[model samples]
Target: MWYEILPSAGIILTFMTIPGFAMYGLNKLVLGNGYRRNMDLRFNRMMYQRDMRLTGDPYKQNGLNAVDG
Candidate 1:
């Protein structure tokens, strides 16, 4: 039983992890440097503004209005 289960588990694990790695690779290829730069900018902004008010809109602090008032 263990012998039979091993192959099945291997196949299941292969199928599960392959697509994730493939998609991650695909995103890296597509987004390239821009994704990392944007993430770094956002991280730095958030780290510097630790005491800023939290709003429902993410772009609020970036000087973009979420709603017209």
Candidate 2:
């Protein structure tokens, strides 16, 4: 009896999880690369600002304070 129930339980779980997994899988397949690139650029810019702050140099190469004397 217990062995018979295991097969039904697997089918029920498949019904529950398969649709959700499919949706996320398709979403990642479609949008994952563009989203990753956008996030990478944002992270790099954040790190650049943080490093400049830690170094006490508020002037980037293009900073207003770095303008010609």
Candidate 3:
């Protein structure tokens, strides 16, 4: 009973995830290099800010003070 349902559920999940993955890959492929570079830069900055906050680095400030500077 349960065994019969597992393959169908797996196939359904695969179908659902593949299109979104393909669209993401296609966007990256079609948008060229500049967009990708900008995205990478933004991601790095976000990660750095998060790390700084976690480590309580005063020099790596947050909030309006950081942006105002």
User: Whose lDDT is greatest here?
Assistant: 3
lDDT of each: 0.57, 0.61, 0.63
Selected candidate, larger lDDT, 1 vs 2: 2
Task: Kindly give the stretch of ten consecutive residues in candidate 3 with the minimal lDDT sum.
Answer: 31-40
> Model 3 over residues 1-69: C-alpha lDDT tens digits?
779999999999999999877866885687532233233688777876665566555234356655433
lDDT of 3 at 4: 100
Worst-scoring 10-residue span by lDDT in model 1: 31-40
In order of lDDT, best first, we have 3, 2, 1
For each candidate in turn, give its C-alpha RMSD to the true structure in angstroms.
Answer: 11.3, 11.3, 11.1
lDDT at 45, model 3? 73
Model 1 CA deviation exceeding 4 Å by range: 33-69
Q: Write the per-residue lDDT of candidate 1 for residues 4-39, one digit (tens) a residue.
A: 899889999999999777876776787552222233
Off by over 4 Å in 2: 33-69
Kindly list the per-residue Cα lDDT of model 2 for residues 2-45, writing each as its tens digit.
69899999999999999877876775687552222223588777
